[model samples]
Target chain A: MSAIGDGRSMPTGAGLFDLPPELAIDTDVARRVIAEFVRGQLRQAGFERAIVGLSGGIDSALVAYLVAEAIGAERLLCLMLPYRTSASSSRTDAETVVERLGCAGELVEISPMVDAYFGRPDTGLVGAAGPEGLTASAVRRGNVMARIRMTVLYDRSVTWGGLVVGTSNKTEALIGYTTIFGDAASALNPIGDLYKSQVRQVAAAIGVPETIIRKAPSADLWPGQTDETEAGFSYPELDRLLFWLVDRRRSVEELEAKGFAPGLVQWALKAIAGSEFKRQVAPIAKLGPRTAGVDYLYPRRRPGSART
Target chain B: MQPLRIALAQTAPRLGLLDENLASHHALIGQARAGGAGLVVFPELGLTGYLLQDLAAEVAMRLDDPRLLELAAATASDGPAGLSAIVSFVEESADHRLFIAVALLEDGRVRHVQRKLFLPTYGLFDERRFFAAGDLLRATPSRLGVGVGLTVCEDFWHLGVPQLLALDGAQLLVNVSSSPGRDLAALNEIGLGTATSWRMLLRTYAQLTTSFVVFVNRVGVDESISFWGGSEVIGPNGEAVFSAPLYDEGLYFVDVDLGDVRRERIALPLLRDERLELAVRELNRIVSERAGQADDSTSEPGAEPGLDVAAR
Candidate 1:
């Protein structure tokens, strides 16, 4: 959606995707900062390796690329978590990334894990949810699949001796579009601060496959499910709105004046406010004088906190 | 006259580890000494890393502390080999209030101590919640044959700090920082917006104050923040003599002729022409008006105290 050679877009020849002028970052600087962040997180936590859930989408693909860029590809493990309903192209695209980066890649199907909870409608598989899971909505099934992926990643985190890297972007995170303790769970997130369009720019810069970058972003929960269609908006427009509303701290009047629809602006504001809890730690009752997040404050990994 | 050799110790301090950071300072000082550095500057809280919420107490040191004495002992010489160093740390007063203090070490002793005046409390900063602000500022004589003024990170952010230092006959102004990098929008030429802003401020201070500006910002990750190390040396005319690479930890030596201060000051005469009494009178009036103790001449009729606008 953007033309090349403008002050905003990526400093490359032709634009790979749309990038909001305000969201346009120096990709070189972003890579350097992210590289340091990835290394810093691993070093602070006494980790030598990192794990990333690669969905073949731009977000996960870019995260995998960044993690691999920070620590060598040899130190990175790319897990392709696919449900039974997940598209075959997702696996192929994920495999392309692994092959390109030469990092360790594995395909772990979450179908059995998901089916055991949600049950199979065609077969008489009485899942743990009794008969209720058989009639479970797609939303419930998607959530279970996401959590199942998280379980596999964490279990492998022990065996692989690597921390899981998050793949959620700012646009989706602000909209409450992520599954808590599921795909949103990570030891550290490198790309959570970037918008979706910005993720594509980074993905393109980092040599993620063009096919993956151009393809419609989807959760791959079901067939023919694209994120834009489901969310009812394009990523460029959504990313721009979030940048102005959240990062720039623009008011409702200011945003409406900037040419966004009043209804759309109201909707985005509501979504940001509604998702506030998903973005923060659960609050304690503060019965104790020095609670963990209250009066007693400490950095996550202090001197003695790092693993020996 | 030979240019003064300054070593910028752009280091990555260990979070909450005083012994380790002190060891690093000692090692870097030895390196600076060997490199013939007349003065070496370390970033703010270089002895104890930035982002120490409760660990400020555990790492705070008094001026008479033996550990500080040992670090100052390295500067014990009166000859040309005598090294003057500026190092920052958490200073605990007898009253138990901790302040972010920078000390000028000369002739094996603490020559001067300047505590940070401004503590940024908003955005990603929480300095005011933990440490107390200093109430004084002065330029002290240094072994390098120049009056040197020292300031911590936020102190230089105030326009008054640099101006007052220059007015007090400071030929060199040094600001030590643990500034975290943010605002990565590409409109900034320096990649990081914080870096760009600091660059502009340092150059402007150097040119306006007609003094050499030395900025040493720390590098490393303490918590979620990464301090971008873009330490620099600006001449009296605002030209950069040296700029250390961003985010690289190294002890860099930058040589600058202190005589440029004399030449630029004589040519510009901005500091000499400064009307200090006029500024003082106006500032006092503004303060009183804001405090509701005096009428604000700029205020409209029926305006509330501290408010300049009145309802029609």
Candidate 2:
């Protein structure tokens, strides 16, 4: 019932991160499996290079490191796409990752694209939405920003000939914190299964800069925005609740008995249920005799499906 | 008595590519023979890969397929130690029923075929939905001078399979698998919960059956699931003879003494003391009771749909 750091070989700088006892994994084994998984995915698809949307946040930074480790850093391209309101410190943190990994990094400012649709109040420029769009809600603008970044990444992928690797973790995907078809789209996701707290644990182990790992996790959609403050729950507590409820198949009553607040458990359950559609493929109406993803099931990488 | 060298081909098969995988098997068999291995084992569906939803039919081969015969011919080619290789693939019956099968090759021919018995249908496995479940379980004599039993992944999950194989006079039990890796947590010795579970099962079955248990699992990604290839060889006394690294693609060799089975069986005598009649009688009573056939049937009136039929 003890964590890995207690009796087993503690990872280097393990004390720097706060990992839940149950979420603490052997970093070595995780790296090995992920390296193989990343390589296998790329090999099956017949792609030699991979592109990652590198936010200064820990999740994407960890993904960049993993891709660099799996395939050589020479083949990895980290795109830092930031909006005008994004914190300057976030860009600095991303630069540190690129410097340490010695991988290709590009700065793609998304303000022009975003402002073109939402309009710019400062320059008094009227875009597609005119004056009304300038005063859009932070949520609407955040979704636009995410989709714009996705657009840029896919557009660049055509030129780079690299697959887009996903950075969203299990915690975000389960709670539906991602913008569907925006940030959630990827050719393959390696760490979509790791919780946020577990993401931090792996980030620390995989040599993500300590400042980035220790910094407050945020979407950087706006100034002073943070995920924990927005979600209203610490990741460790939320992850533990999710572990019992989803992974262990514990009933809400059992989760309450295990000392999780009933209200928190109920809210978490709601989020997971509401976000269910984002996790799977959109179902096709079963009108035909044989439908793809229905009766005509086939593996993603069939014989001729690989990129020749 | 010479120690038998087993070559565990922990390969990563291309998803739904039959000819490419067939070529790999042919080369690996020759390599294993050149290395002086008497026995070589490949993972379940190594010839056609796992996660082949509708592609199963496209890659399936019949028992009389010339490609299978040619692959078998690679095992015994005038080598000092004639090779006995257990290769797995999708089998197409005369009636066109697709089945996951394992064939034992010796003397340049298909010696015996063991179709996979338990088709796991729950969780990530959609096997039973596509392939037919095998009906027979028997041990065959091998060129290794001992009785051999062959099984697929989920076949060993049932406790009765290994026991039945051992009772049928098998000294070496071989299980080929394409088991997907999931359930990662800090609770297990290894980071993988699946590997932890499989490792425990291999050791336990080895000791209980008093037989050498050899497990060969594939390594590769099929869609979302990645197969963990921690292939292992367990001795008769539940000790690990050798363990291949997880997720690494290579041909690994392990030397196991066939005499160890005799030594452990005589010392433990667990198999000898097994009461087959008692188990059969209890099984029959339970089956009849569950079916509401016996007078002492404990089933409720509507517990099972067949109870009314039993009453009629």
User: Which number leads on DockQ?
Assistant: 1
lDDT of 2 by residue, B1-312 (tens): 559999999999988888999999989998898898999999999999999999999999999999999988887659466899999999999999999999999999999999999999998888989999999999999888899999999999999999999999999999999999887766567788899999999999999999999999999788888889999999999999999998889999999899999999999999999999999997887678666677444545555533434343
The fraction of reference interface contacts (C-alpha pairs within 8 A across chains A and B) present in each candidate is 0.63, 0.65
Q: Model 1, retained fraction of real contacts?
A: 0.63
Stretches of candidate 1 above 4 Å error?
A: A1-15, B304-312
- What value of lDDT does candidate 1 attain over all alpha carbons? 0.89
Q: TM-score of chain A, model 2?
A: 0.95
Alpha carbon lDDT at B14, candidate 1: 90
DockQ of each: 0.61, 0.59
TM-score of each: 0.97, 0.96
Model 2 chain B lDDT-worst window of ten: B303-312
Worst 10 residues of 1 chain B by lDDT: B182-191
